[model samples]
Target: MDEVEIVVAHAERATLRVGDVFLKVDVDRARAEAEAEAMALVPVPTPRILWHRPPVLAVAALPGATLGRLGGPVTGSPTAWAAAGAAIRQLHDAPLPSRTGRAGRSVAEVVAELDRECAALVAEGILPADLVARNRRVAETALRPWTPAFTHGDLQIAHLFLDGDRVTGIIDWSEAGRGDPLYDLATFTLGHEEHLGDVLAGYGPGRDVDLDVIRAWWSLRSLVAIRWLATHGFDPHAPGCEVDVLRARM
Candidate 1:
């Protein structure tokens, strides 16, 4: 690549690509350290770490396109989707890392935050009150007790890379930790609900999972993310994005 490419950028952090190297610049050194640690522990494909200094971590680029972005069309096949799911399961099943509280948010904290966001979404006229309320109710199913696992707290499609039918990489370990497994699954298949079956198939049937809880997390995540995405210079209202995810519930 002749020109430097910005993978993603915001106030808190930014990721830039120079040729085959990816430079992740963060505001918090601790979070960057934790990301490197999590990637080292997880039993999955990850970019090779080049070096890390405070507020910046460098890694070699993985050779594959991402499965899909929030507002993008599906690029990976059903088999590739299944491979991504299988890779997620492997990561989740692995032993929880020693330094694993990057997010450290409790379920009660999540519920409280969701409630606050929902109220604001309606009161500020960001979204219809009925839409907010209906999804809020739908999001409740995920509030029940759950076993914490080694979860990629933000397992969206952008973090997942696929090559043919194989999961080439799972990147962005900043959010990996001991968290609700369903939350990760829900996040991975958030807007891409159509391929959920393929994911479930590869996630395996040995473990019992509640479909309602996954649906609940869908609402909960989309509700809480609207304001942040908007403020971060992202168009959450764009087609096939967060707003579309919320609208699907109604």
Candidate 2:
């Protein structure tokens, strides 16, 4: 009956610890789909189905620190970025059968939707609205004509787990879908551009990426972040190096 530490998972859902049981509550259908999709994609520490009647996923607790907490890639480091890119390529290259049954949205469509949301907020006199369209356009232009490959809808450092130079596993499959292979790459780049080239370079050549589409997603993500910060009364316009990159796009 007592609940343990609650870690953020997705909207309205938290991976809660109850005694020795790790229960992922909320949005059963989506969680189920993500779990299945993740199992098919990569070897990660995703939750497992514990009971179906009420829907529960039992996941092993990650013991090490997340890559983001471990000083990240140190900007221009080739090892971390290159390894990340390889992992993304491997993920994108995999077949996503789960997506076959779900309706998919293009990167542009997703960005446009986010733009509409931000515009609506502005109309309602909402301050600190996210305006990263310019940045989104840059990335989308690069990701256009995306390959018919699987995409990890939200591929960020927070969702990735690393052990030294190797990627131990990836988490959060709620946004997993089928689309251009470069979706993950674009996500990675938006957060780590200096090292993105390293990841891409290590992933190797010949695999075409839709940079435009990635930009669209990245733009949407920035807008989402802005809204999130604003809603939580956090700094919407933080003065950081990454802030400049994202702001320039807006």
Candidate 3:
């Protein structure tokens, strides 16, 4: 008999593991639809879809462990990280999907939201005002316009599965869409800046990537995500956590 294990449970979503199948239950049907659609469009390896019902999606478990966890040391080799980068490059180069719902934000909208979130962080006294302000300034570099590409909007390290030096699968496509390519790169390398060179090497040459903008996105993303994590009962202030990532920017 397959015993069910709760993988993650939060207000917005929950995931369960039963034997070889992983079940994702989302509060938002649109998000579930987008995830399914994105997974179908990406050229890279992804979990095989088993079935779907409204609000619930099931996929077969992929082989191997996650690439790494946030705020923790990455156990995967540099070769694996490079392979993940190449996979991302392939995804970005693929034809744009038509049903990219709510995929990206305008520069002005992003800046405005950043300001709002920064104020909340200050008011709540969750982070130092100076640190927030400095990072906010750094985030300005990412506000300029650029050519868009197919992006896994939330490409965190833990979402990638690896087997040896190869990328076995990428998961959690709820935020996939047509967006800034650097955002995906920045998200993947967040808190793991040491592996950026490996990723870039596999991402290949001739592609102009602005390091400053990537760093800025790192700052902006961490600052914006602090409250959400806290509200969801997750710690952002732990060692090497999002808060630490922001302070490290100094």
lDDT values, one for every candidate: 0.87, 0.57, 0.88
RMSD of each: 1.4, 4.4, 1.2
Model 3 poorest 10 in a row by lDDT: 97-106
Candidate 1: residue 247 Cα off by (Å): 1.5
Candidate 3 structure quality by residue, lDDT tens digits, 125-213: 87888999999998888888877789889999999998898889999998998888899989999888899999988898756799998
Give each model a TM-score: 0.96, 0.73, 0.97
Alpha-carbon deviation at 226 in model 3, angstroms: 0.4
| lDDT score, candidate 2, position 193 | 52
As for TM-score, the candidate ahead, 1 or 2, is: 1
lDDT per residue (tens digit) for residues 1-250 in model 1:
3679998999999999999999999998888888999888889999999999888899999988887788888787788888888988898789877654523467779888998999899888999998899999999898787777898888898998877888888899998788788888899899999999999888986665788889898988999999999999999999998888888999
Model 3 stretches with alpha carbons more than 4 Å out: 101-103
Ranking by TM-score: 3, 1, 2
TM-score (C-alpha) between model 2 and the true structure: 0.73
Candidate of highest lDDT: 3
